[model samples]
Target: MSSSAFKSSERKLEAQVKLNDYFQEFHEKFVETKQAFQVFKTKSFFYPDPDFIRTFTKSIKQIESEVKEMGGSLSRLIGNQLGTHTQKTVLNSMEDVKPESHVLHTVSDELTSEHADVLVKGTETESITPPVSEAGNDDEVLGSALVQEGNVKVVDVKKKLSSSEKKRGRKKFLGDNAVIPKRPRRSLMDEYVTAQNKMKSISEEPSTKEQEAEYEVQTIMDFKKSQGQYFYKVSWRGYSVEDNSWEPSSNLTGCEDLLLEFYKSRLKQQERTKTDDLNYQVMPHDANHQHILHKALFSHINNPTQKDYENSITLLASPKPPVLKSQKEIAELADKALSQKKKDRFYSVAKTLVENMIMKELTGKREKQLAELRTWERNMNSICSDPAKLAVENFVDLELPPMDFVYINECIAGEGVTIPSDPVVGCECTDCFTDHKSCCPNQMNSWFAYNKLGRLKVSLGTPIYECNKRCKCGPSCLNRVVQKGRNVGLSIFRTTNGRGWGVKAMENIKKDSLVTEYVGEIITSEEAERRGKIYDAQGCTYLFDLDYDKGDQNLYTIDAAKCGNVSHFINHSCDPNLLVFNVWVDCLDPDLPRLALFAAHDIKKGEELTFDYNSGLNSKQMAGRLPAQLTEQKEEGCFTPEKRKESRSELILKTPKGNRGLQYVLNVSIFHNVYQ
Candidate 1:
């Protein structure tokens, strides 16, 4: 082959290679630009609000659909170019290479636009010059001539030529000599190539900002659903427009760790505030027991006695005489009874009648007293009030003491307060009645010995007695004998060893159990004080020893010493097993007042019964108020077990200095038997 031909062929091949490089570069840039746009569109769609997210997503989808169509066209154009390159490479060795003018024109038109905006004004329009044709009619000559110079080597050569030709064609077709306006100057490939490069850079860079924005938008959208609020302000790590500074965004939603930490801190603050509020209130007190006992004792003292009233009558004269001799005798006796002066006769006859009525009235009075005593006993026993059938009323239920501490014993009549004679038969040496003094001691054999006034005196180890009274052989006895009746007393007595004796219950008793009820005067603290002051003003000797506090001036007066009862044995303990309860003994019959003691804690069998003396008493009075004791450490300690135990031995008693002047003395012993 000739050297000139070979050189021409080599130049052609080089030009083709340059064109392929530029096309490949342009295609790559286009792909990069498309990818960057896709990322931007995706980021824009991620909005916080649900409504906004929907709108943005719709817009992005529309743009993406358009881009996909454009991509298909661009792909086909790239395929065509690649096919032309392949054909040239394979065919160039066997035949004279020819530049296909029609193919070149088509390719050029596709690569460049006819728009005048991209061209440089006044530059030579050589690209538009007519294509060189072969001199001979042979196809080989045309193909060889077109391929000879390899002038197609210029990058984007076809594009530049097509742009120039279109410009020239427009001017020629107008047929006017007028010069066309100068077009703007720009590099031939600047817009397309530059855009492609910018796109590649964008696609290469990480989509961090995009992803963050998308997450924020998602959080905001979910916030309305999860938090149920509108217009939430989101904060995160980003540049702030307001401060023109970079910092963490204030709003954080997706991170659960921070939210939980914030909530826990708030809860702790609330708890601390609540605790502070609770520290500023005061405690309460209970005083039901003392109130009831006071009422019972007071009622018994104030009630009027039967001896205080008079009982006599006189008759008017009659005109007719009696017919029967018996009637005449009765009439004569009646006249004799009524003959004395009005006042004098009334007194004499009433006195005679009272003495003669003793036996008959005694039986009736005894029965009446017994019935009333039993009723009073029942009231004293109950710790709580009965439940009402009506739902609207509220009742304070008393909590009772456990079983094994309360006992009831019958009362036996005595002489002028002396211990009554032995009512029970069957006696022997003291050994048979050891620790049962009621059967052995002649002085303390009666139940009446335990009764002081209307109250019963109870002591530790007091013996219970069984009465053995025989019925006289009279009408009543004969009737009882016919019925096979036995003569005996169900009453029991409390014994102190085999020596002293008192009344006691035969059966086991429960704590807070009702023992007996004593009736007395009931007065308020203020009333008692007023009465005390009145007594003092009247120069009554009994009021001289009364203790009065000027500030409160309240006092409690009891006839306890005179009317001591089994209820008196109950002692006070700091840590007591029994509770003294108060009840309005007769709300309907307020004249007969009473009080009761109930077991507050569990009581054991045979355990000395005790209660808290200062349970409801104010703290000021509790100190130094217990009974005196014989202890070694009296000066240093506030209280000793021995001293405390000694207080239980003290008995509360009444004196003549108005009931309020009474004091308690440690005459009775509680642990005497236990120690002995």
Candidate 2:
């Protein structure tokens, strides 16, 4: 054969080898997936599928067989080009490239009984070296003998120190959180010691004046980029253009949601401007038609003819004494010009000035209706020491739950779910919030048991709903508690129970206090089901079926399994301090109500926060059991959307109408630890 032909044949062989490696890798992953599924099947349900092991094994063998056949075919194609000898050599090479099958044994061991030999022969692992027995039982001899056998290891266990031995000298810890445990009961002398060590925390709190001022971010006036830092010229609430000051990103601190909203709005505005510019064809200037900006800004003026347009430009172009106008005045004039966008280019050449004029968000009424789209709560990586291991994206001092997280602002309508348009044209009273109730569209009427500032009056099971942006109530409205970001201190803790992880209160939480909003990617039922299978195999599911209304058949689900907030850390408890509520704000869509988890009763600091999976309703009916699927009986104040197998009396008492069906029939056995 010619040299070129030989080189071509060699390239073909290389490609065949690459294909073989990929197929082998895929075959191993397939085996692992099969093993994972079998594990899930056996452990997830009380009565696991009897034929699961047989079926899984069959599937794995079939897939591996196909992979081998594919590799063989590729080998044949390349081998035919060379001679019969080359083909035999290639086939021989394939025999040596077998992937390890350890997963099969691991998965099969759990399923096997004394009578069943589930593990196949040749796949079984045996000890490479036989177990050695020492000639003597003496400790020194055994230890020496183990050392002599290079394969054996002699481990010397260290003796633990007693509390008394360690307490002889006072020790200092390196970490900031290190603390010495104290007795529960303290005498008068202990109080003196405590007083001597305590520092005044009052000086650390924000001043009364500062707290009273409702600060909000409206417009990003200017952006300054520095050597690793970014600063924004912010317009504070109740402040004018002249009073606006440049603030560091740190000063905005907990208001990351607002900053993200500002970013998204700017992006949208840029997109709209591009669309607007695209809509207009770049035709040669029609002198008769003035620029759109000029026309819109000075719409009060009469129609300008072609000659009059020329005169306006001439007057604007004329060299006059430069006026010392303030930035606020310039911004105001620009705001007027660009704000009134009636697309009749009054001054065609004033494109530069028009581009510079931006309408900020934090100004006037827009600041009050805090419903804009936000991007991030905060950059988790910047705040967290390790972000990959933590399930959530926000900074939490403790380890997060063993789950995935994705951030989202609002819940979207899932498949088969319908968002009802039952928006109450709420009362426009500025004092409705001040009074802690509203008569307009009086939903579930005995207004929520919240204070004038929206805090819970006492630990009660009443649901809380804040006045939406549609209402004329101001930002400080008492009904607007949930929207104000995380108000109570919370910590994501690793649960001691088999329930994985959960959230705990860092401070005492009153009854009806907002814990955290159950935020995550709002996906459709189809997408949810597709993901459900994968999550099921992994043995952890965070998909929540939204049943805020039973009238709507379209099932909606929030799959917080992947993307979620701190609420994902709140685990299920049969007797729970927290309860989930369907809160509607912004647009009144019945189908896409926000899942707000509030305290059902007062919670002590350091206590784990939990809510029943389906909240006193049957689990199968709502399919609300998460991760570990366990069916539970209904409890009192069962406010879930869908109720299954209700008797005639139960149905009559609990209809999905307004406040008429809001009565609670309390149950006693609700506090048991039955929830998983």
Candidate 3:
């Protein structure tokens, strides 16, 4: 019975009448607008009535727009009832062919012309009816119609087009000269390379003085020169932004007032930037780490118990009903589970639903956080995020304890430190690793034996000589140890021991590992002597004398007491794992060579790394390169094992004479620990 009633309503048609009524009212206004546009074009454009012309143009545009809209709706609302008439109209439109010449028309002109054509073409619309005889033909009819961006006219028809194509409507038939932006122009520069496109855009501008009635310019965007004459990029009062052109000063006379205002505004903007109060306005730092810091801050998690979490965004939105997306997914899972085969042993509907919901809550938040972190990683700038590239020489005072030294990458000039200017030593070794007979070994009997990884095989108390840049043996030379720079990880930390601060091995460092350069300002022997007196008063000293070759022409001292590398923090130790060595590379300047420290033994992870600092340069080291010792020099040094029994007799009762035996015992302990 319900189906029968729907069929009955179908025969007696409805719903379309509301659309027809709306279009009927709209069509009346459209006809009225078409007539008014004709009168204004003939009178208002030519006559000098600024306000009336504006009002007249506005009225015409509004009405034309309604009519165009009405045409589309009327076609849709009328449906099959007006099918024959629409088909005839489309056929007639096809007969009206397009012209070959290109026509570039603005919105205003297009609208004006459309209305004018409506008034003229009103009579021809009737004659377009398909003859009563041809109405039965299927191939010769258009049962559907299309409208453009509110352009309602049967102006074009292409047969055999799909329904979607017909609904999309037709474009204007343009000639070859039409500038349709089809594919993106890969390079306009390519086109400008030829002589043809080298156009003089403003060869001659319209001069207001010459043609005051025709010239029009409203405001200036930018300034330029054309053919040696000054011009402004002028936006005409009644035209679009695209219609702006480079008009000469003579042409912009009409808009001088506006042009003056533009310059004044620009000047004010400049002044605002220059103002002292705003000159240092905080902005995003150019460094990448600053940006990363900002992003990380915004994403910082706020705990529920924190004071700020009371106003937390998550808590604030919690009261709102949870979005139904998760529930929907859970329900879908329940349904899927219910349909699953019993043999497959799928979960029950209740279990599946509960699990799905639990999983959704868990995975959803995780997915969101992962997505955000991934976005942050992708957005991280190359320069700022990479710690290695970031040149942060100085440590933050709050995070690090007060160091009585400045931070510096390389050595600077000081009282006693003089930079070296010496000749170099070259090596003739083809492969320093395999061939122990390399020229480098012949020169100094290479202190360290190394593998391909440049780790030391055994610790030998000898001077280290590396291959220079002049060597043809290449960078992988075994003797080329210290100059390659510190490779193994190490950390500087404040010590619990009497030693104030020290360097620690972050990794298992092999015996004879090139730890770090003892970088500092190289001072002269005279300067070293003066600074020693000052350090004695201060109760601290970071000066090391270069006595490797003993009294050279230039006796130098490295004063890392003020500024230096990781090696500067290495505290002195009587039983040290690290040993100091004079490593020469780049320049074989024996006078002021680099002082590199190497592990004297296999240092374990987390072990304190130290070298004998105040100890005299004994063994192969040349003497007489040092200043007077500010160090507490013991009157009695360590004793031998043979003398221990006799030495103990003098030490048993805590006598001043027994102090030598105690010192001797301590020295022996240090010697054994270092060697072991």
Candidate 4:
């Protein structure tokens, strides 16, 4: 043979080897898919998982592309050989073509199973066929074979199956016909691409519907009047601006506040010179205008009641500046603007200027209040030596820093109330719990309140008597925990629910750990009654009655409304994690015991800390043990702890003032043994 001919033969042999390798890979993938399906069939009575089917289908598509490429190469090779031989000789050669055992040998090497054996046995009895091209004559049959291992059976690639045989099962025969459908060669590639597109479309249809269904209006961005009808541009939550769309005003029924806000922003953006324009309106509708007028009037009425004053403060703290206009001024402006509808209306622009001035004043006040709160937080933190830090957050509303509310870590004697100034006798023991003799617990004639871990070892209602200032034990004394103050990180956050300010644990708190003392003005019971009535009328109470003696004549009370620690901000929960205990420290006066709060359970970080404001009182006991004002308030549906569920986190009570009138015997604080 000539050099060129020899080179051509070598190239053809290389192409054949490449084609064999591709076929062997495709065959192995097919075998694995079959085995997966078989296992799936055994495990489930139904069809295989859709995800598996999708993956297998993708593999099949890749193999089909490879098969098409191989077919094209084979067709070229056959055409080249045909140039030197007659059509009759080519047909004779194809008839004599045999199955390649090496392909099967390669497949067997990779897969070992009964399925592999069945496939290899079937291939031995079948002939491999090279696919016939569409351009080839109908009578011309090209043949070759892949004789390999597995349960997979092979049939003639060109064999025309009867309708009955086709209906028997959906078993796929490995050949060019299976990989690429029989069609006009011009449109074959286009059909495969179309099938893939159809599959993708079907798979993506549900997600598109889900996306449409999930679309929610996060806020109204802008509004426009088109042909006298309003259209608000709404931004959807969890999506970008690209997904925003304009919807008719009627479509946004429940989003009136958002619409009102958008209108307010638009009004703010308007030029000051346009105030005289009759069309310069604060709201799109008369009802919205009336709503704003009502709110402004109710919030800033002259000789305002306590509730009205509180409303004014809340509005003043609003992130958006209040546009305060008198009702009379609004009415006069509306009438003047309406009467001169046919002509140009001349409205005074002073109202806008007044609104701006008022906003500036309120903004200044809010800034000052916020600064005061920050200072208060700093001062409180400075008084503590604990590693835990205190943080404040208020995104709910512009609630000012509480007025006349003193942050005290220890109880202070109020008017008509007296706390003993003398220090309690000291414990000389090295380990108070180990050496119970002369220890604080021995002095109290009770068991040591804490175990080795510095957690409360006593039962829930036990009184804790810690080493006092005169104690021989050092500051590290485990029994000196409550006196040392809060060591756990805590955050004072403004609750979204109408429950006002609340405290949440910033770090995980173990069960029976000392949280904080409910320090406030210690008042006598007679004073608490007078204050409780006033608090009830004002819809708030901070009077915690010291009813530890369990007598009808309770002597003292801890009033925390204006004077308290971080405990004052703590809300009430139906399923409370905090329990109060009477803790005696520096002052051993039984009537003036310190109220301490302790973790009732292992509390997770970020979980809001709450104590039972009702002090675990049953309905009958509540009526008898609680203050008269509280009982009256309860009867009128103001203090209903029984109706609230733990899931709500904060107690849903009708009070602007946070505290639940009084605390009784069984409540607050953990006690630990001595470290001395």
User: Which candidate leads the pack in lDDT?
Assistant: 4
Q: Each candidate: what lDDT?
A: 0.31, 0.44, 0.45, 0.55
Residue 96 of model 2 has an lDDT of 32
List the candidate 4 regions with Cα displacement exceeding 4 Å.
1-372, 382-387, 617-676
Ranking by lDDT: 4, 3, 2, 1
Model 4, TM vs. native: 0.40
Total backbone collisions for each predicted model? 46, 21, 7, 22
Better of 2 and 3 by lDDT: 3
Q: Which candidate has the top score in TM-score?
A: 4
Runs of candidate 1 exceeding 4 Å displacement: 1-50, 58-74, 81-201, 208-676
Candidate 2 overall lDDT versus native: 0.44
Error of 1 at 283 (Å): 35
lDDT of 3 by residue, 1-676 (tens): 2557634433333344334334444544444444454545446443445455557656655654455444544434343433356434532343233211111112112333222232222221111222233233222232211122333355332266564553343244343344332211011111112211111221133321243354466766766545655555778778888888875554442353565455445433433453334332122121212223223222221112332322222322232423434545654553353233341222244343333333344445534544543443233223122122111111111122333555555556675344653435666778665554547645554433355656544322334567777777776666677766677776655454445556777778876567777877878878877888888788877777665554333376778777776677777666666656556676566665677677766889888787665433331221221111112222123111111112222211110110011111112233232233
Name the candidate, 1 or 3, with the larger lDDT value.
Answer: 3
Model 2 — TM-score against the truth?
A: 0.33
lDDT of 1 by residue, 1-676 (tens): 5668756655664454345345434433433333454455456443434344446546644643454344334434433543486545543553443333222323334443221111111011111211222111111111110111223222222222455775676467433453343221211232333333333443454443343353332221111212222222334344343423221222232443433333334323333553323332111111212222223222222232354211111100011211223434433333343333343443344344333333233335434544554444454335212221101000111112112223222211122222223333333323322222333223233221122111112221122222223212222221111012111111222222321112233334443244332222333445455666666676531221212222123233322322233433334346654433222211211111123443333345444444443343222222233232223233222222231232355343321123343333335474453334
On lDDT, the stronger of 3 and 4 is 4
Better of 1 and 4 by TM-score: 4
- TM-score, cand. 1 vs. native: 0.18
Candidate 3 residue spans exceeding 4 A from truth: 1-400, 413-418, 436-438, 444-453, 457-460, 551-554, 615-676
